[model samples]
Target: MSSLAKQLTGVVANTRKLLDLCGSLQAENDMLKLEVQSLKVAVDTSIDKNKQLEEKVKALTVARSLDEVEVGEAGINEKILDTKQKINDFVREIDKCIELLK
Candidate 1:
């Protein structure tokens, strides 16, 4: 029965090694899950920021069209200044988004 005992001991050692490997894998899986959750939050925030930027662009387009149709020499300078301000604001917002990504 010495050979049988040796076989049992070997089996136990292998089982322990397998259990250790499984535990290690479990820890890695948990870390990956947390990372995925964090990335999802980042993606959602980016989507929201992009939507806001899209709305701002739409507003800018509308303002430009209105200026083209209704602007006169009397108000052209004012309209130009307003459009420039809007453009600058849009640029600042884009810069903020870029900074967030970085």
Candidate 2:
């Protein structure tokens, strides 16, 4: 009877230890799951912000292109004005030559 009692006591002690280990593992699992959820939320927010930033960059690129086109048009207009001035000068010279001949 004494030997049987010792065996039973050892078995009960081992069972308690196992139960404690299981409880600790369960708590750790819960904490890890919560952490994973938090990380997921943070990642999603970053993705959204990145998309918005990309859109803004695209809009800026388009605006810059439009500005370049406008500047080019202004340069073309200046060239046209210079050409018109030269033409006017030539006409004056032609009139002077005609008057002298007459």
Best by lDDT: 1
> Residue 15 lDDT in model 2?
100
Q: List where candidate 2 sits over 4 angstroms from the true fold.
A: 71-102
In model 1, residue pairs whose N, Cα or C atoms come closer than 3 Å (at least 3 residues apart or on different chains), thus clashing, are none
lDDT of 2 at 40: 100
Once fitted onto the true fold, the runs of candidate 1 whose alpha carbons sit more than 4 angstroms away are 71-102
TM-score, cand. 1 vs. native? 0.65
| Cα lDDT of model 1 by residue, 2-69, tens digit | 99999999999999999999999999999999999999999999999999898877797957655585
Estimate, for each residue in 59-93, the C-alpha lDDT of model 2 and write its tens digit. Answer: 56545544555357787676566556655765886
Candidate 2 contains a number of clashing pairs equal to 0
User: Which one is best on TM-score?
Assistant: 2
Each candidate structure's TM-score, on Cα atoms with residue i matched to residue i, is: 0.65, 0.66
- Whole-model lDDT, model 2: 0.79
lDDT score of residue 51 within candidate 1: 99
Worst 10 residues of 2 by lDDT: 62-71
